[model samples]
Target: MSWVHIARKDFADAGRSMMLWALTGLLILAVAGISVIPYLLASDGTTPGFEDGVGFLFSPIGLLIPIIGLVVGYQAIVSERESGSIRFLLGLPNTRRDVVLGKVIGRTGVVAIPTVIGFLVGAAVIVALYEGFAVVDYLGLLAFSLLMGLVYVAIAVGISASVSSRAKALAATLGFFVLFDFLWEFVAMAIYWTVEGSLPGFDGLPAWYLFIVRLSPGQSLSAISLTLIDFVGAEDIDLTAAGRVAGEVPFYLENWFAWVIVTLWIVVPLGIGYVRFKNAVLS
Candidate 1:
């Protein structure tokens, strides 16, 4: 069978299940937290209408998409391993590369649909309510949302392919997702606090320190997403002087550099995991 057929079947299995329901719950919570509450509690008698609400609603998509990706992709290979079916697949003439690529594509489709739908619905609501909507900006935001999904799905698939136990796979995915999303911010904040003096006074910190912080997939992605949202008037994040200085790097240079970093976050661990899975002992 073609890998496309396998990918399609996997996509269907991942989609028509409780994962969709969980994603819906997350959408409700995020929409409510950022949009509904803020709208209802506005001190001014006139609430920001649906357009403003939708803008607010999308602010958390960056945080939520990765979690959705983890939930959707974490069992792709690990569960097969646990049930002794991975060997059966390997027994086929197919290459391990096909299996890995197919599973990643399938899982990506599963998460991508809800992400696109939620984003469209929110954008449509905003257009209906707002007098002048920047349609192009919304499209760019949707694209960024998908990138956010891709990043975590890649990470989760790597974890799945490398692990043996389904439970451990799930725990590792959730734990790492939470750590990267929440704890990483705490660590970054600690760094900022520790070097507040040097950060302001010194010529510059070592490239090593910047590289370590830049490796935070969540931090960089979230910052970029927030900047995009701010440009669209969706969110109001204050850009520090440091951020402004960083942005002054040549556009082409900064763009390619950022892409390289994002690609590394998605590719390096996945390549490592793929190598491990290819060499895994299947007895």
Candidate 2:
């Protein structure tokens, strides 16, 4: 009950944030553009329908939602602490858990709602142009995208709560963003390069290679999106023909497991941060 009030307050407050509005606009524009461009360029036959357009958005959404989630959550606690309003938050009959949970819920809404709406708008465009819509794909994309957003919101809010300063929180969150978003791929590739000589080309790479990619939250989200959305003009999840030929890469490499990975990301960070926030004395 108390968490609801806190979450409601934060949700209402987002209305005044020009930066959020701007980012939201950018997200919408990017999504809509991705959703509509192919139809515009298609010669009325070779091009696919709105379903394909929405599916096309999977990659971009997987990339952009984390940034939006970070923006929404990075300052959840530290900004309030810097402004000394976190004390005010704590003063209002709120426990550390309540504050943390409320912020996570509020920030999740901040990123997820806009994202789902953008995709829905794409669906509308598809319906109008194609005269039919893939409701399952539309809904699944929204559901998974929402889950992905919450996963990152949890991570960002956890970082915010665990840190003592806004700068440190921001740095940590951005570092996390980079770690999952870009660094993980590079690190995996480096490992692959170092070990490639021992194995045959690409297909001969071991299960541990896929394990390293699975370690990243972004990779997990992208992989989850693959399960929900049928992408057009995109190849199968197999990165190489050899991976396809490898005959069931590994259990962790499976699509359904990506959702499990996302769930872990949501829980683990929030748990760590909640413990830290519960123990720390809020000044």
Candidate 3:
């Protein structure tokens, strides 16, 4: 109950900030504006289908949503600590667990609101320009994007709670983004090269190799996305482990298992953060 009040207050405070509106506007551009690209790029006399728009949208969304989540959540708790308001917050009935939980819920709302709005506006654009508009598929992508937002926010918030300083939190979160989003593929490739004596290609990839690649939050979400949104030409190119692996797809590599991985990403960090924050001596 205290966490609920804390969550409400946190969201209300954020509601008053121009930062919230700014994020909403940015997402509007990212979802609605970026979704228009397929139509614009379509060849003459060819009207792009809804799947085409969703497929084109996946790339930018995969990149953008995580960054946004990190940015919004990184400072959620550390800022209060830095400003010495955490002592005031703690002076209230709220426990350390409540604070962390509240921050997660509040910051999640901060990301989700704009994301939902952006998707709403994007739906209009897709309906107008695209030939076949599948409402279920559209909702699927939106749900996945929201889930992605939650995963990153949980991570960033966890970092914020564990760190005493905002700078340290920022550094850790940025390092996470750079490592996972930018260099994880290279890391996986290097492991594959070192072990297999050659780089992994489209098919014939080992199960362990695919598992290593899927460890990143983005990749896990991407795997889940294959199930969520039916991209144009998805039949021709199989992104799933079943398509890439030589033998049977391992249970861990199954499409449904990606959700388990993503859930772990959310839970492990928050659990660790809560434990650290719980034991910290508040001066």
Clashing pairs in 1: none
- Which ten-residue region of model 2 has the weakest summed lDDT? 236-245
Best by TM-score: 3
| lDDT for each residue of candidate 2 in 62-158, tens digit (9 for 90 to 100) | 7788788888898987788889988789888998898899999988878866776677666666776663577887788888778878988899999
Top-down lDDT ranking: 3, 2, 1
Q: Count clashing pairs, candidate 1.
A: 0
Residue 75, model 2: Cα distance from true site in angstroms: 0.3
- Among residues 3 or more apart in sequence or in different chains, the pairs in candidate 3 whose N, CA or C atoms overlap within 3 Å are none
Cα RMSD for predicted model 3: 1.3
lDDT of each: 0.68, 0.77, 0.91
Better of 1 and 2 by TM-score: 2
Residue 205 miss distance in model 1 (angstroms): 5.9
Query: Where does candidate 1 stray beyond 4 Å?
Result: 28-38, 41-51, 185-208, 226-256
- For model 3 the local lDDT of residue 207 reads 94
Deviation from native of the Cα of residue 282 in model 2, angstroms: 2.4
Instruction: Give the TM-score comparing model 3 with the true structure, all chains together.
Output: 0.96
Listed in order, each prediction's TM-score against the native is: 0.79, 0.88, 0.96
Estimate, for each residue in 75-173, the C-alpha lDDT of model 3 and write its tens digit. 998899889999889998889999999999998999999999999999999999999889989899999999999999999999998999999998999
